[model samples]
Target chain A: MSRTFYCRGQTGQQLLLGAYGALCRQVGLGRVKMFPRTEMLDLVVAGGRARGIVTRNLVTGIVEAHTADAVVLAAGGYANVFFLSTNARGANATSIWRSYRRGAGFANPCFIQVHPTCIPRSGDFQAKLTLISEALRNDGRVWVPKRRGDTRSPDAVPENERDYFLERMYPGYGNLAPRDLASRAAKRVCDHGCGVGPGGRGVYLDLTAAVAGLGEKVLCERYGNLFEIYERISGENPLHTPMRIYPAPHYTMGGLWVDYGLQSTIPGLFVLGEANFSDHGANRLGASALMQGLADGYFIIPYTLGEYFGGAALGEVSPSDRPFVEAAKEVEDRLARILAVQGKRTVDSFHRKLGAILWEHCGIIRNAAGLGAAVEKIRLLRAEFWENVLVPGDAADLNQELEKAGRVADYLELGELMCRDALAREESCGCHFREEFQTACGEALRDDRRFGHVAVWEHAEQEREPVRHVEPLTFETIIPAERSYK
Target chain B: MKFTLFIWRQRNRGDRGRFVKYELNDADPGMSFLEMLDFLNQRLIERGEEPVAFEHDCREGICGCCGMVVNGFPHGPEKGTTVCQLYLRHFQEGAHIHIEPWRSRVFPVIKDLVVDRSVLDRMMRAGGFISVPTGSAPEANTVPVPKEAAEVAMDAAACIGCGACVAACPNGAAALFVSARLGHLGLLPQGQPERERRAKAMIRRMDREGFGACGNHRECEAVCPKRISIRFIARANRDFLKAFFVHPGKA
Candidate 1:
């Protein structure tokens, strides 16, 4: 049903470079003026329409306002909310979160993708997890010890004793099963005390069978770079033994809700790429994020944006407008307040704690009780973060701590919203696998009749619960079918 | 494992930077270099001292936002590893690691280990991309490209624009970086329309940005996290010379 075009293991890199080249050409022509090292603090909405944005000059720490007739945001996803995700350290929900607060509807906050293949967290000091390409699943067979708490070396574990869970559970797909399914399966096995490696958190991705069949040279040629990277970080060569991998937050399917026109609730405000929750209904297919992003930028936006412009009338808007000034001031005061909190805990400490709270309750498999507990814990954590977090730096300079503090504060709020959304969506569907709603085989059970609508949450005032609004999904030609690999 | 760290601390671009020493007693061998830095920063923040400001994104080494000098190596002593991907096990226990920002006149230190590598972005803007029409997907096989050319283009496109080449260069030259950008687009048939203009503008912008001439020291390739070859520099020079002969008026 799907086809993939790739250049070795560097598909994402090649595609990004191609896009970057085009952007640079425009920049060279003086058509695009880039503001590097700048962070968007707030979205400016004047006259009930999106107009501009307030950004902090990261170099000088100056809060500046930039107004435009139309604003297009493609600021990426918020997988970093987990603290130890496969996302960049700088990746945050700030831009989209600020937009949500400024009237954009955030849809499906709980629909986050947990990638099956990632380097397992080594220690408490581990900052972020690295993702191994899904291509490894083609040859690498995922397995764990047949006995619970088996401490023997991976190679020492006899072939018969190794329980190949993926192949056992989903014989049709095996290791190549969908990310959400595989991730959930791994968690299920680990929860049952059958996990391998450190702290019983990982499973063996054994490629010995494939290597023996294909030869070491062929295996090396296929995934040489990945193998090297694995060895570099874990200090364990995959060729010698099986690789230890665990599920980690890789992407967020939830983002600022946008319509067919790629425009959010606010007029003149367009969202694209992963920033907009337009594509990938519940789970994302492999290599599709890039394709969707390219389509949004290169095709969809060109037409839809023009259509938006054609419909709207000309309004004289300037960066010195009242809305821009107020937004800029708001950003500045928030920064000042964050700096004023000269408390004990570091931003990283709070972020790590928040990550733990979410990962424990709202991660992989969630239940109503745990989600409720998570929401309460996050609320308390957010309050503690505001009052007790130490951001030791001035607002008038390039302060990474201040940036992180603001982002973490936003994540604290977003984390609660995620729990709330997850709690509301009672039935299991795709990545949102509720413990109470799964089938006998522990597969996601979708409640189409009652919960087939897209859960869109609108931001309410401080200390008030967000208003949940739904848009019913109507299937016309193609009927929604239950996914089964077995 | 215990290790002493000498970290560069700069308040801002105008501030004079100094090396601050701190002893870390609980650095795990499993922790990445950046994780170790994060551990140190957490300690500093808890002590009411400002944490080090470093630019890091996509710790997987593809984003190219993280680059620093560690023990006189661009990304530590590793052959082709970024600071984010470099692990503590690679270093000896109780080693006094000297960490600093990328040393380049063009890339002024903003605060601590964070440097203004926007110059590289500027160079990219000059002539890095192929100008294409934005619309629906173009039909594949319309313009046939040589298999070899496509492969070479991919190799050139692997540059993360981390500015490590400039930082490691003895003359602070961005020849390797610029050439990688040039080679990525120039080898493609789609890039042929504005190829000459791209080469001239990008090379001129590189010189204008105060980047020194390549001294053939091969330092950039040696320190590059992506292991981008210096051969791309030669490829860029060939394109530059052709552009120079073709468009003498622009020169």
Candidate 2:
């Protein structure tokens, strides 16, 4: 018999949807069984080996445990912890918490990338909009008001009146400074009130001259979709007007600590794609995320798995095994406890409140004082979340509220860990910028003396501090130097 | 500005899709076509109706998740622009835009505006790789590929796999997608061992996926978001014909 595969809903759905379609065409759709919107509640641990997985099918309201030789978690990273992340709707930091609570090792959940350019938040209610890529910065110029407190639009300022800060600062790379630096620069200007857009939260990315000089055809060729996206969100035309762009938490460079083989500290469980922290050291280069994901799935994992299986001498373990049953029962009991709770606050309400606190305290810029306050705030919020949180639906159905509640519960824990990690790493390197660690020139200072290792956190008991495992990075090719575009 | 949108709506693979029209008034010139549609869907949801389903992830021009025929162009009239990159500012005040899913036998419509392009993935599986073993990161300058050659290969590697080439093609040929991978790997020394075999295997897989034969319409090159040249198609054809002679068994 063929081995059964365990995967989550959204991420798993996209992968299996493609994989099944390809496999079915090769060996008929009759041979494939796809399960979506299902929960992988527990991994059956049998004699230091992963035997099977227990899952609850949301569509059919059936709880089933499937036996498999190996389990792969392409679940994704903990981006939802940051209130301002640009991750998809379904993914939450809770998944990471559940995995850890069930004894999965995770790494660097705090090394999140605040994409240097995104459409700034329009209203308090707006969650997060789409990000325009860094590629636009190659051609489009970044500018702000020359005056320290000017809040005028691009049309009001003549060419000489505007200050193209990036160009003046770095002539070589200019506006295309690696994401971390660029994001900081935008924040600095916005905080000074020279920011454009509705809330003075963005700077102008002008392509009006580029459009006129290169012509619409050439401009469209370079950035058509980006132009469309800008128009859609901001109601502006790049062909005539400048686009208001700012940074938001986009991709997480930090994830479950995995080796070159994409295997985590846990033996049987494998993390691939964006879930595993590899390739990208501190900051990811342009157009590399897709490369890493496809490379991990299609090229890397298959060979690594073959080598692993060959060495392990693994045999089939049935789903009826004792450990599988126990794990499944544990999941069921947890769900029952959550469902039994009758509370007043809705899941969305708690999540929104959590997001607000996180964004205010932990987002963009962070210092020890802010992080300490955030930790206390998060602890208090988590307590209220457990006590007053209302989940309107049952686990058996497509309960959006239940899903959000579970994810928010995870976010509360993950947010605390993020602050702890941020607090511990005294140096500002790449995306992780602590206000206390920056230079007088507004550049991130790297303290290679004390903190140049990957921070891997081992999950401890509730209210107990997690153990930290340090993996010292040895760079053979690129020597550690102050990254200066100037 | 106000405009009329002609969108393609197909329920499933067997269902025949046609252009359905909707009107919008005082639209922002800054909004993308998809964003405009998103606004329309938000309205539809408020009225207790099913929103139009579309495939999009990472709205930045990278992920290759979103693709469709917009105003008879693969990524609209924009050159080197993907659908996700197209801004509404390029359009007139009262334009009538026609939109449709990629018309290809290999890529069938899954739902409204979403098409299955896993056939491209199948082609990649057939060969498009370096066959390097796992473990240890290679030194950056170890390969010593000339900057020119590396740049060309990188350019080819930039193909987003959006299938706009197929959407733009009259025959719905996936040559642009196939040739891009072929050229990307084939240009490198790491791809030397399986050079002939890779070309033969990938082309065969491309044919097996039910994509039409390349007829040199040059539409694929025209609409490519990265502006991958047609020279790659010729390179792929040359390699394919050469492989037919050298590796008959593999072909």
TM-score of each: 0.97, 0.67
lDDT string for model 1 (A1-486, tens) is 212322455777766776676676677777888787789999999998888899998778899999888899998999899999988788889999999999899999999999999989888888889888878888889999999998999888898998999999989888889999899889988989999877899998989898889999988877878898899988988987899999999999999999988999989889998888878988888878988887898778989988888988859899888999999999999998998988888888899999999999989999999999999999999999889989887887778888899999999999999999999998999899999998897788999999998999999987789999999999999999899999
Give lDDT for model 2. Answer: 0.72
Residue B201, candidate 2: how far off, in angstroms? Answer: 20
| Alpha-carbon DockQ of candidate 1 | 0.79
Report, for every candidate in turn, its global Cα lDDT versus the true structure.
0.88, 0.72
* Deviating ranges (above 4 Å) for candidate 1: A1-8, B136-140, B249-251
lDDT per residue for candidate 2 within A1-486, as digits (tens), equals: 111111111232343333432453343224445454577766666777666677877444466778777777787766666654677655555444565665666677667777877888765445446666656676679999878667566788888989888888777678767777778788888888788777788898888877778889977765655576567567778788888888887777777777777877767767776777777766777557767877888788888988788889777677677777788887777666666665666565667677777666666777889888888988998888778766554666544445556667778888888788887888888878888888888778898878888888888886799887888987899889988778
Question: What DockQ results for candidate 2?
Answer: 0.07
Which docking category, incorrect, acceptable, medium or high, applies to candidate 2? incorrect
lDDT of 2 at A425: 82
**Worst-scoring 10-residue span by lDDT in model 2 chain A:** A1-10
DockQ (CA atoms), all models = 0.79, 0.07
- Cα error of candidate 2 at position A42, Å: 3.7
